[model samples]
Target: MVSIFLRSLVYNVLFYVLLVLWMLMAIPTFLLPRRVFMRVAKAWARSSIWLMSAICNIKVEYRGVEKIPNGPLIVASKHQSMWETFALLQFFDAPLFIYKRELGWIPFFGWYLMKSRMIGVDRDGGMRSLMEMARRAPKEIRGGRQLIIFPEGTRTPVDATPNYMTGVGQIYASAGVPCIPVALNSGLFWPRRTFMRYPGTLVVEFLDPLPPGLARKDFIVRIKASIEDATKRLVDAARAEQAQLFGRVPAKT
Candidate 1:
């Protein structure tokens, strides 16, 4: 336990230091094309993944990447830890994220987010904000960008009940593009609201894409079922591995 604690401390410190270095190095891309900045962002994601494996003994496996289609689409992923927020960027040509508007107020990070033209919405705006996102999303989709959205809207614990929002369905219905459901067990290794990083396999599987033109109600139901079921399998598998590693699975907070 003490060894794990020390490793987690070192990983966290290096993670932020690496982020600051990447942000500073990426500054020149602010004036360049969006794709230029995107390339840098993807590099950061790869570097972070490598760092996790090197220092924390967390191996990452991405399955069904060949299933990702070209052109505009929606990538609806399970929300667990902060890992996927940036790690998933490497797979898409032009990735777009809808984030809290307040994050866009940060110094360098916010400036880069604005430069990349990510969608920012006010959390307090309620239905109006959803409507605004619905209105703007299709335009970006039409421009051939892949929108990555978390159906749950926020991270949940590995064993928590699933609470998927209808916002992703709205975007799917509005964008008129196929939606890819991604399932992963990231929370097992990178648990939220804590500094301890566990050692295990982190799997992100991109399941089959749901075709466009389904009713919003049906779309929501299908997406929720697909992500939750796959996520359960992933979490269970990781828990077994953790048991083997430590003689018992870690307790959920």
Candidate 2:
């Protein structure tokens, strides 16, 4: 317990320090081209992943990376932990995240998001917000940027009842691109609102893409099925690995 506490504490401190430094370094990105800005942004994510492994003893393993198709596509993922927010950036060339509008208010961070041109949605604005997101998404998709959205909208504990939202379907139908479903077991290790990060492998798998032109209902069904099924397997596998690593199974948080 003490070891875990120490590791988590060190990770949190070092992680935030790196974040601030990266934000400072990213100030000049606003003047650069979009692709250059994305490269800078991905460097931050890569460094954070390195810190997670070096400080917290949590390693990440990605599967089915080859399944990611070229060109503009929708990458809809299961939201279980904050790790995916940064870690997933390395996978795409120029990825645009469908994130909350309030995130655009944070000082340097928000400035970076604006410069990066990430699509922001006002969650409380009801249907209008989703419509706005859908409206903005196609522009980016047409510009050859991959749209990364969380179908669940927010993070949930591993094995929690999934709350898949309609916004993803809206984007898929509007963007007219392939939708790649991503599943991960990140929550079993770096859970929400928790300082303790367990030492084990975190798995992220990109499932086959659902080709464009499916009806909204069918798109939603396939997206949910692919993510939930693979996510459940990852969660179960992580728990089993945790049992072997720590000598006890970790309860879903």
Return the TM-score for each candidate structure: 0.98, 0.97
Looking at model 1, residue 57 earns an lDDT score of 93
Task: List candidate 1 segments past 4 Å from native.
Answer: none
Global lDDT scores for all candidate models: 0.92, 0.88
Model 2 score (lDDT): 0.88
Give a tens-digit lDDT track for model 2, residues 1-253: 6898899999988999999998888778788887887898899999999999998788889999999999998999888889999899999998998777899999988888888898777879987876777788988897898988888878988878998888778778888889899999999889999878888999999999899999998999999999999999998888888899879986669
The candidate 2 region of ten consecutive residues with least summed lDDT is 126-135
Candidate 1 — worst ten consecutive residues by lDDT sum? Answer: 166-175
User: What stretches of model 2 exceed 4 Å from their correct place?
Assistant: none
- Model 2 scores a TM of 0.97
TM-score winner: 1
> What lDDT tens digits, residue by residue, belong to model 1 across residues 26-116?
9999889999999999999999889989999999999999999999999999988999999999999999999999999999999999999
Error of 2 at 249 (Å): 1.4
